[model samples]
Target: MAATVVQLTESKKQIQHTHQVFDTQKQAFRNNPMPSLLERKENLNRLKRALLANKDRLVDAIDRDFTCRSKDESLIAEIMPSIQGINYTLKHLSGWMKPSKRHVSILFQPASNKVSYQPKGVVGVIVPWNYPLYLAVGPLVASLAAGNRTMIKMSEFTPHTSALFKEIIDSIFAEDLVSVITGEADVAADFSERPFDHLLFTGSTSVGKLVMSAAARNLTPVTLELGGKSPAIISPDVPMADAAERIAFGKAFNAGQTCVAPDYVLCPTDRIQAFVDDFRARFTEMYPGLKDNNDYTAIINERQYERLQSYLEDALAKGAELIELNTANENMKDSTRKLPLTLVLNTTPDMKVMQDEIFGPILPVVGYNSLDEAIHYINDRARPLALYFFGYDKDQQQHVVNNTHSGGMCINDSLMHVAQDDLPFGGVGDSGMGHYHGKEGFLTFSHHRAIFAKQKFNSGKLVYAPYGKAVHKLVYKLFIR
Candidate 1:
């Protein structure tokens, strides 16, 4: 009973601290409503330097959190992206910050119009556990570039990484300028309820809904980076080796915990077996063994491990074929939470693996008779965050592009679309909404305030009070048509 009371007291303290930090950031934003371009650039540079200086520590922290996360995977997926995103923002910030000149209609003579992209003060970023460093820093880069004070809520599931990240952030930034909050689910709920000017969440669709609901209380605009079942379609003409290699890398990276990972594959019915064989071969080549392998990553935790296991069990019970890509055939049951890349064949719409976003290294291959059938299958489901189409034929590629709806696409590739700093990253419909990355990231956290200046002439006054004046008639005659 005393321990429960102590836990409750600690929770209260954490909630209080979150509220205090939020208020501090809000006031700080008010004080410096518009940060200068040089200031923004310096902020980005500082972030970049901090990340580089502590790269090894950050990688180690994530490894400890996941138990068996590969150092190279953390470096590639998390640290590299975070640094790249900051550098991208720094390079493009000046152009993005300039007041955009807009057309001044001839009807309104002597008036100049333009749009000023002003920061939306105090942005809230709720980072997910899968790639904590990148997700947190990606949104932070944008928010800082747009001159907004930011507070990040790191995931509790990645406690070591989250704690280390908070320490690093605190060392570099004042609480008023930037802060990182870490706690359990209740603390996250409280953080979401705070009245941030804009909130960006990267997590599951269900949690996104709850975050949106909380933001609604403050009428806070949100950019939700939610996940769904992203699909990779293999064209009938594409070589199985090519398609399988790319798809294998996409699903195998970070053990397929990526939001944009290929959740399933849509392959030609005739080449399904060939694609399967090639994919297995490619994956084994990448990791040769699972247990005690430094290059291979384990599932994040036991809960997630069991969840993926249950998915396999459920799929098997429903008569789906399960192929475990355990090349060395080592018993992983008694080892760490490492799961071999498992493939689910002959999947139906009713299977649990097909229905949910398989965030682990579980790939389900669904056979399609024709390109039209594959396109129709994708169209029937919720629009995914990303769709990968593998084909060399220009007509077939364009056909798929025109018929499909997805946040992003890759032709003859997978997962590389996200690495391109020039492209905007997001989702559509059930997958997610709103975009961030490059200029879109800056815009998402900014409010484009329209400005109109009239120096000498007041043209609008001509039609102001009198109902039937000559000038008013002339104005009406000119514009009414």
Candidate 2:
């Protein structure tokens, strides 16, 4: 094992430049204001065009960064979703922008109440490296739809992808409307210090806390998309092979780097061995030639690879058994940080793999005596970003959904809940804060402005004049239920 080191570099001049950039944008937003409905629609269309036009370049950047991200995955998750989100907002932005009516008291006869939608001005978006483009551009799409100028801070981990995305954004949008800031973690910390109307961050829980504290300095509201040890529960009634295939597809996708990927599996004790056997076979079927498969991704960097290695080593040292899907083949140790697709059996709560998020192709199979035990195990951990259940029984599925709270859940599947435009996507508790995607994304970036209007007639003179018994009686008769 190698020593792990995480370094972030940002200069003072860069920090000053970022502050000035955002300040200028804030001023522009206040003076010129965001475009009207027709103009906003045109802007959205332009953004869609840019994303569609540059799909190949964007996908190539992701592949260079992750080593195995499929073009199809990038198109579906990053390009298409962003375009679809804009279209969804375009179809409904008019209704969403309309002032909501409120009931007025009869005593205040000429007075009326309504709530207007207002932009929060100059929103700051801090994106993670895992889903570099999606995390960066998706939030920007929503912010633009809500009529707010946005500034994005791309993670420094994926330098190539970050630089490419910055170039793409700079070419299409103005600095005042949309700007990209790319550097390192120090830049992120400094960016968080600068006052902004709102901040949205997607990363780890520990980093998410720091971001929250920084936002608290200016009392700026924050929307956090953090990670958790998301769990997958396989019911006894389901077909073992089908469940294993779906789980394998999600767990090994991008080498399990997704924030919402199933970190572990909860299954009945009686079927533990059978489940592992089926899972191993399914993984092989999905990605043949485990050592040299292009579809299988290498770990992000040496740091992450070593961190996962430490977790596996610690778990193995503690007597947990490791079952490799390709046990007969030699380990791909010579490659650039390639971790074998493996599972941990006899896992206990205290094991490091069980305690922390397994952000690699390592799955811990924890057997439970009963369904109650399975639900309790999930509830005991911090609410995860996503929960997956494989069961055909509607009542059983609902039972799991209703009993536990997660950012999202999928029935008989894994990682599919995010595809729905109607459902809100986010986390609860330590997992994450605030929701986004589709309408939820629009609302997250919008500010509802409550307005009260009154006619020239000051009909409330009776109550203002005196607080006597006659006025009190009138107030009671009109206001009391």
Candidate 3:
């Protein structure tokens, strides 16, 4: 009972701290409503230097958090993207900040119109655990570029990385400009309820709904990067080797904990076995052995491990066939939460693996008779965050592109669309809403305020306070048609 009381006391303290930091940021943003271009560039450069200086420490922290996360995977998936995203933003920020001139109609003489992008005050970023560094820094880069004060709420599931990240952020930024808050789920709920000017959340769909609901109380605009069953399709004529290799890399990277990972594959009915064989071969080549292998990453935690295991068990009990890709046949009963890349065949709509976002190294291959059938199958479900189609035919590619609805697409590839610095990243419908990355990221955190300038001329007044004036009739006659 005493321990419970102490825990509650600590929670209260954390909540109070979060509120204090938020208020400080709000006031700071009020003081410096818009940062100069050079100041924004300097902030980006400072973030880049900090990331490069502590790259190894960040990798090690993530590894400790996940127990068996590969160092290369962390470097590739988390650190590299964060640094690269900053570079991309720094290169394009000046152009993005310039006021956009709009055309004035002939009816409005001696008038000039343009749009000025202004920062939306304090922004709240709720980072997910899968790729904590990249998710936190990705939104932070955009928010800072737009001259907004930011407060990030890191995931409790990745405690080590979260704490280390908070330390790093504190070293470089004052709490009023950028702050990192770390705590458990209740703390996250409290943080979400704060009245941030804009909030960006990266997590599951269910949690996203709750975050949106909380933000609604303050009428805070949100950019939710949620996840669903992102699908990959294998064209009938495409070579199985090519499709399987790319899909293998997509699903195997970071143990398929990526939001944009290929959740399932839709292959020609005749090539189901062939695609499975090739996928298994390619995955094994990537990691010859799962046990004692440094390249293959393990599941994040025990709870996630059991969740994936239960998915397999439930699928099997419901008459689904399981093909374990344990090439070395190593015993995995030990403490390492490593799970082999398993393939579930004969998946149905009711199975857990088919129904939920399989955020692990579990790939379910569903066979379709024709290309139309595959497209229809995807259309029937909630639109995914990403859709991958493998085929060289231009007509077939365009056909799929025109018919399908998703946040992003990759023709003849998978997962690479997200790495491109020029493309916008987001989802559609049940998958998610709002776009970020590239120009979209800057616009998402900015309010495009339109400005009209008229000097020595009051043309609008000619039609004012008069029902049937000659100038008003002329104005209507000239433009009404």
1-481, model 2: which lDDT tens digit per residue? 1221222223556677798899889898988675688866777787788888888988888888876666677776777777777778788888877778999867777888997777889999999988898888778878887888999999888888898888878888888888899876788999988788999999999999999999999999999999899999999889999899999989988789889888999988899888988998888887766566767777888899999989889889999999877744856788766687789999877899998888889999999887779999999778899999998988889889889888888888887787676778888889889998877777888888788888788877767744776887868886797
Candidate 1 yields a Cα-based lDDT of 0.92
lDDT of each prediction vs. the true structure?
0.92, 0.84, 0.93
Off by over 4 Å in 3: 1-3
Q: Please report how far candidate 3 places residue 404 from its true position, in Å.
A: 0.5
Q: How close is candidate 2 to the true structure, as a TM-score?
A: 0.95
TM-score of each: 0.99, 0.95, 0.99
- In model 1, what lDDT does residue 432 have? 88
User: Which residue pairs show collisions in model 2?
Assistant: none
| Model 3 agreement with the true structure over 353-420: per-residue lDDT tens digits | 99999999899999999999999999999999999999999999999999999999999888999988
Error of 3 at 97 (Å): 0.5
How well is each residue in 1-481 modelled by candidate 1, as lDDT tens digits? 9988887788889999999998888889889999999999988898888999999999999999988899998988898888888888888899999999999988887799999999999999999999989999999999999999999999999999999999989988899999999878899999999988999999999999999999999999999999999999999989889999999999999899999999999999999899989998899889898898878888898999999999999999999999999979899899889888999998878899999999999999999999999999999999999999999999999999999999899999999999889899998888889999989999999999999999876877777885888988888898899
Name the lDDT value of residue 183 in candidate 2: 72
Looking at candidate 1, what is the lDDT of residue 420? 89
Q: Output the lDDT of residue 205, model 1.
A: 95
